[model samples]
Structure formats: C-alpha cells, structure tokens
Target: MSSEKSKYIVSAEWVERQLGAPGFRVVDASWYLPAQNRNGAAEYSAGHVPGAVFFDQDVVTDRTSPLPHTVPSPEFFAAEVGKLGISESDTIVVYDGPGIFSAPRAWWLFRLMGAKNVYVMDGGLDGWKREGRPLQTDLPEPAPADFHANFNPYAVTSFEEMRGIVTTGSRQIADARSAGRFTAKEAEPRAGLRSGHMPGARNLPVGLLSTDGRFKDLASLKQAIEDAGIDLSRPVVTSCGSGVTAAIITLALHSLGHEDNTLYDGSWAEWGGRTDTPVVTGEA
Candidate 1:
C-alpha cells in the first residue's frame, strides 16, 4: 500500500496556502461535453479562482486534426502557454469543475510541452467551493511570458504505435470509457461513432480513479488499477472517448509511480470510427 503523503495530488487546503506565491500559476482547465451545453470560457469569465488563468482545451489543441482535442505541436503549445503567462519554470496548478477529470489533460499537456513543475488540484473547483474558498468574477489580464518547449514524443502514442501494440502485446492498452461502452452494451454519446472497446484492452473507467471528482488515496488507486488487470510493470497506453478523459488514467498511473506510459490522443474517436481497426465487445 502506498502512503497518501507520497501522492501527486494537492489538496484544496494546500493550494489555498500557496496562493500568491512567486512563479506559481493557477489554471482553470474546465471542459464540458457538448451535451452539457456549457461554455468553459464563459464560465471562467464569470467566476474563477483568484490569479487563475483559463486553459482552453479546444484552442490549445491540434487545429488541423479531425479528432477532438488532439495534442498540438511543441511550437503551437509553446505559443499558447506563452499567451497564458505560463513558463517552463512556473509551478502550475491545474483544476477543473469536478475533481481530477479535465485537469489531468491540461497537466499532461504541460508535461508534454516540457513543463516539469506541474500538478493537478484535487477535488478541483467543486472541492474548493465546498470548502468555502474565495473566488473572483473579475477576469485577469496577464502579460504574455516567454515559454520554452521541449517536445517529448515518448509520452504520446500515434496511430501507428497503437497498431503495433495491438499485435506485439508489449504494452497494456487501458480504455477509460464506462463498462457499458467498452462492452458495446450502450451506444456512444457522440453521433456516428461505433460502440466497442479496443481489442485486447482493459476497461478502467476514469471515474474509478476518482471519488466525487477528487482522486482517491494512492493505495486505493493502485488497487483499483491492478484489479482492472493492468500490469504496472509493463508500458501502458491510455485511451478514452476522445482522448480527453484518457489523461485521467495517465495521471493515476503517474501517481502510482508508473513512469512508462503514453496517451492515445485520438482515442476511440479515431479507432472506433474507422472501419479497419479491430474492435471487441464484452469484458476483458
């Protein structure tokens, strides 16, 4: 069992204490499903934590990709972070509406872009508000900072990489979609998408890694992951509906001290949509 003290998660209390620290940046990385009918940027403009900047998921992605929120090039990422007043040296604390959901995607993005001092705020804004932390409606206008990016390609899985994994069996493919979706018992929320899991993949829903939007302790996290049949000793490639929630799995893997992992940015949106990719139904 792992100790909570060694976990990567930061409590709202610790974040409150670190408010206004030099070189510290808080980011509101809230994202919503199309069905939710909520605009993330609009919500951030209305009320957000003090000194927190908005990290627009859609805008910071690969604009040319047909898939949703695919990872952007290092040059593109550096430019976007520069506009947000974020630099490689800054300690970035990212949060979302729920606990650890969308924040991990942003944390993963920063890490991919060469930012080492990045973290996700546990329980996110929901926990912060439940604890009566202060919030501000006034939008901050921060001057752009110089951001240097060193792209790490190892952290991302290309379609070719996934194709190789399908046959080699060298890496564990973990799908973060619900069991119903993974088993093809339920239709995908997005229209025109196929319903099924990747062949030879293990289903580990992202919600299992969190409790009411907050991440569970390290011990519980490890147990949940291993129980899903994922071997932490081997490499892992995380995937989800559209590669968004997959980062939740990546974050959980990191918290458990598993370093060899990558995120399938196209995720099910690409794999399930295509006719050539092999799909499987039923539990792994």
Candidate 2:
C-alpha cells in the first residue's frame, strides 16, 4: 500500500486494496463542529467504506469529565474499542469525512492505546467517494475481539502539567485554533471561555498544516511550523479548542521525525474555560 507524507498516512487507493484483509480494521473517525451542520454518524449511516466501523468520538470518551471528548481510561478504552472487533495487533486504518482533520486524533489515540501500525487514510472518505471507490450502506456485524490496552500515560499532557509548561516554558505550545480565535478577534464557539491562547504558545492554526483535507509534504510541514515561530528541535505540546485538532499538529511533528512531543489533553477547553490559567490575545 502506498503512503503519502509518512507511513502512518496511507492513500485511499491503499486503503481500498486492504479492505477486509485479515487482521486489518477500518474505522470512520468523522466528527464535526455544531456550526459545520454535518453529522458524522448520520453520514456513515448513508454510506461509508465497506467493512468500516464508526468510532464515535462522543461515546468513546471519559464521561466522568465535564470537558468535551476527554480521553478515556485504559480499561474503558479497551472495553469500548474491543467491542468494535479491534485488537491491539490489528492493522487499523482511520479516516474522517474531511480526511486529515479528525482522523489524526483517532490515529494518535490508537497509538496512545498501544496499537502499532495504525494509519490515517489520506483524503479521508471524501476523497474515497470522489474517486468513486466502493462504499456500503450496510453495517457489518463484527465479532468482538480482545483489545488489550497498553496505554502510554505520558503521551498526553494533563492540566497541571500544562500549567507548569506555560509557567516554566518547559515546552513550546502550538495552538491549532483559527487565527481569529487565537488573536481574540473572534469569540470562542463555546460560551463561558476566555478568548486567545496560552501566554507562550505559537499560533500554528491547523489550517497551515494541510490543504483540502490532505497533509502537506515534510518540507512544507516544517516550513509552516517554523514560520509560526516553533523550533522543531525543542519539545512541543499541541493544543486546540478542545483536544481534537491538536492531533493534526502532533501528526505533522511525528511525520518530520520529531518524537519529543505530546498532546495536551485538556487543551483550550480547560485553559480558556478557567480563570486561574493565564491567557493572552493578539498573536502568539
């Protein structure tokens, strides 16, 4: 199967060829903002890749947390993903409606949960459909498999850890929110949250890292990040409005062979929503 930027990102043609291959699993990881007016589940019900299962981001989260889409515990993740007939050893490929958007989050999560060889489908289902690849409206009843969760606790940065990072500048913070939101020129979608970003954070805005739902090449990825004032050699922690799009930055970093990175699980949803944490406006 051919890949695009990295081995973790496979082309739609490759994914189509791997359909129903033994120990290969496909997951539709589509999600959208309320303003987008798109329903991932409803769209999946209409039609999706054959033998693909939906990974409901809303349901597969830490329900106990007040925040939206918090990463669930290892035990909880194991139980939920196991029901989808996915094992840690399986060659899992995840895709979203807009390709690289939400798919990287699933790819990050799968890797965090210790599923090696996980990949994101380049161009997503949108590209798959545009290419006129096979799609099925019928949902397959997959036999449940044992998904052993070898969770890596260090992959995610906690609120407290983020606080220290901001205070000490221990790691460079790369925010994935839009330029308007990051600069406090636009109101945050979620009410009761402050506008702007962390004090020392760089405004990478996830859009800079991709084009038409596909990630940029390694050189372009590096250029976009460097233009945003981020040093690839230093440690970085990715953040977003919630924790979703931050993964796109994480994927970009990983694609460039930058391994000293982690995703802040709480992100702006926790930082901007709180009065205790510091927030600033007007670029970086």
Candidate 3:
C-alpha cells in the first residue's frame, strides 16, 4: 500500500491510545441498509468506542433535497459538525460497525469541508470489539466548537454536470452498486426507480474494494478498479445506490493518489428515479 494511503486510515490500536488525547476526536459513522437490520443510533447507545460520538448519517443531511443523505450545504455541515465538537483542525477518526463501510463518507465529508486531519479507523468497530478494545455505553457531551467551512465545490458532481459527462464522456463514471443492480438482473432496494445503470457507467461494486469489512491491500484495490474497467490515470466520478458506499471508491482512489475524482452526490437515487436520465441494462 502507498504510504500516502496511510494518511487516510488508522488502526484500532492507534485509536484506543488516542481516546483522551488533546484535539483528537472519534466518530461512529455507522448506517446500515434496512435489509441489514442494524440501527446505528441504538447500537451506539448500547456500546461504542470510549469518547466517540455518533454521526447520524440520516439526520445530518440536506433536508431540502428529496434524495437520501444529500451532502448538506457547507454552512450546514459546519454547524452540524461544530455541534459534535469537531473543529476543522482537530484530528478526527471515523469508523462504522463494518470495517470499511459508512465511515469513509464521514471521512470524505470532513475533508471536503476542509478538515485536514481526518482518517478512517481500519477494521471498524467490529474489529475493535473482536479485539476486546474499550467500549462505553454513556454518551459523551462534547463541548461545541466552531468548525469553519472551506467546502471544495470541485469535489462534488451535480446532476447537471453528471448529465453532461454521460453525454460527452468527459469523465469515467464508476458505479459502486452491485453487479446485479448495475446490470438490472436484480431489483433495486428503492422503489419507483429504474433497475439498470446510467449509460457509460462501469460497475465497481463497493464490496470489491474491501474484504470482510476491511479494505483490500493497495495492489488488490488497483486490480479491482482495473477489473471493473476503471482507469486510474483518468478522472473518475464514483456513484452508488444513494451516494454512501461510493465514498469507498473515492477513499480507495484517493488512497492510490488518484486525486482527479469526484463523488456524484445524487447517485442512482436521483438518476434511476428520474425519467429524463437515460438508463441501460447489462454491463458496461
């Protein structure tokens, strides 16, 4: 793995030591699909890493948007994270129940909002528990801190820009949905949406980038991207069912030093649900 990628990830052991360290903050950014039968908040109340706060993915979003967990405005993100006692300069480590799943979304959000020292906890909370690391049931009352927003607009791709990309092929589209969903072989989890994918979009299922909840090694990640027909040398826009798991692709790409990439905020939640966008069945 590239040493550069290490900047984006920390081990559970490191997090355990940083529990009460100055300017160090840990966040549990767990969210699961309805089919997974997991409740992030409830589970958090039951047990979480000591000194870690819960990041409600569902609640901390752009409420005005009809789509799920749309990236909130910079001001909104600043305010929400500030309420969580997260300052832009603090060292932040985010993790979820599964090793490398929803945590990257929070990591990407912090970085996109201009936090410089954000990282995902490798092996997630699951691995932490397996190792008999510390856990606490009591919720923390973090003192609110000011989080200045330095949002990077370029890190995000809107529906209009995505349309132009699909039409002009300006950037490669990497869909992180499963092969079944990308090929329309299986039904989408959300209703009133098309089953296939956008034209020119390559299937790069988020699961391929990781194994047993932990991300794959650097060589494996590169192979997975190439196996999905994605060119690391070119710009990429990562997408998924709603835009959550897509960040895994973003995390993997950024780890490999592929910086010319953006996350499609609307993802399939907006694309497939709309009639105007073109949808195609089968593989890329």
User: Any runs in candidate 2 off by more than 4 Å, and if so which?
Assistant: 1-4
Q: Which ten residues in a row have the lowest lDDT in candidate 2?
A: 1-10
Candidate 2: residue pairs that collide: none
Candidate 2 local distance difference test against the native: 0.92
Off by over 4 Å in 1: 2-6
- The CA-based lDDT of model 3 is what? 0.92
Candidate 3 wrongly placed segments (more than 4 Å): 1-5
For candidate 1, lDDT tens digit of each residue in 160-222? 899889878879999999999999999998888889988899999888988887788788888
Query: For candidate 1, what is the lDDT?
Result: 0.88
Quantify all predictions' global Cα lDDT against the true fold.
0.88, 0.92, 0.92
Residue-by-residue lDDT tens digits, candidate 2, 192-259: 99999999999998988878878788788888899999999999999999999999999999998999
**What's every prediction's RMSD, in angstroms?**
1.2, 1.9, 1.3
Lowest summed lDDT window (length 10), candidate 1:
1-10
How does candidate 1 fare on TM-score?
0.97
State the lDDT of candidate 3 residue by residue for 1-284, as single tens digits: 54224458788998998889999999999999898999899989999999999999898899999999999999999898899999999999999999888999999999999999999998988899999998999999999999999999999999999999999999999999999999999999999999999999999988888777777778888888999999999999999999899999999998888999999999999999999999999878
